[model samples]
Target: YCMSPGIVLTNACDSVRLYGKLSLRRCNMDDDDVQWPFEHEVLLSLTHPAGEAEIHLQVDPWRDFGWYRKPSESNNMSVCYSLRSVDLDELTRDGYVFEDQLRIKCKVVP
Candidate 1:
């Protein structure tokens, strides 16, 4: 996960920027069994205090990108999103934030 300060919008200045990126980082352990360049749809969600506040986002893998291909000594990140594109303010207002902590979930569809 990566985070940064609020980003300015060109068209809608009042609109909030994304919370940050949620990425799939490769582990150092050998993953020869796994196929290269993921080709599945990813389901990402933010746990909400109120069930109605839960947010779900779907992302398609960038199979053609080198970052999503085979890994090297340095574990690379593949298939990414902006915390599934949920803004910080929205998350907080929706009860997705608790005690300054946020919970995120991910699922890959083959």
Candidate 2:
């Protein structure tokens, strides 16, 4: 088993485009020894009282990398991603500005 250590947002918590990066770190929490080479897409979903939208991004750190084998037996590892051309501020500022807490959500793409 593994535990998601939450997400680290870049650029002082401001919006990001193709220039920003996000890192997701997970730690080993169970019988699994030497976890590696996992493939999955991460979706960044933005939700508001009015509506919501989801965007998919590559994570092997970024760009759909296959076979990301990180030899970590200690339980510290991370996945990074390059932000797409989406602007968060503009998305939320359409009418109601989202309080920082209700901004975005991170998920493992299914």
Candidate 3:
């Protein structure tokens, strides 16, 4: 997983969006012996210092990017989401980010 900061979220002054990526699998789809054959859709719930709620978001990443564990796109896995300012602030507050406020789980899909 990797995170990039300083993403502008809204028209509000000094607001930013946090970008994140999570790798769920690393096997090629053509490999019959691979365990995960079906695509994965991630379900996430983020906890913030301001409040806690399950924000429904599309799992699509920026179109120019491909969601894969390796250089190949023929993998049976994909999912992504956008992060909020309060969540990002809490994550990087002390000049060091240790834990992710987002709790994620996966569900297999065709």
Rank all candidate structures by their lDDT, best first, as comma-separated numbers.
1, 2, 3
Each model's TM-score? 0.65, 0.47, 0.35
Tens-place lDDT digits, model 3, residues 1-110? 12111122233455444443344444334555554321443333333444543333323334445544343432323344444333355345633233543443333333
* Model 3 / residue 31 / CA error / Å: 2.5
Estimate every model's Cα lDDT from 0 to 1.
0.53, 0.44, 0.38
| Residue pairs in collision within model 1 | none
Error of 1 at 86 (Å): 2.5
For model 2, what is the C-alpha lDDT against the true structure? 0.44
Residue 8, model 1: lDDT of 22
Candidate 2 residues 1-110, lDDT tens each?
34232334445456543222344234654425633324455555445646645444444343344313443453434545434544545645653245544445565555
Q: Each candidate: how many clashes?
A: 0, 1, 0
Backbone clashes (count) for model 3 = 0
Writing each residue's lDDT as its tens digit, candidate 1 over 1-110 gives: 12111212122366554433334444644465555425676666676765665576666656667765555544455335533455667667777778987666666667
Q: How close is candidate 3 to the true structure, as a TM-score?
A: 0.35
The candidate that achieves the highest lDDT relative to the unseen native structure:
1
- Please give the lDDT score for candidate 1: 0.53
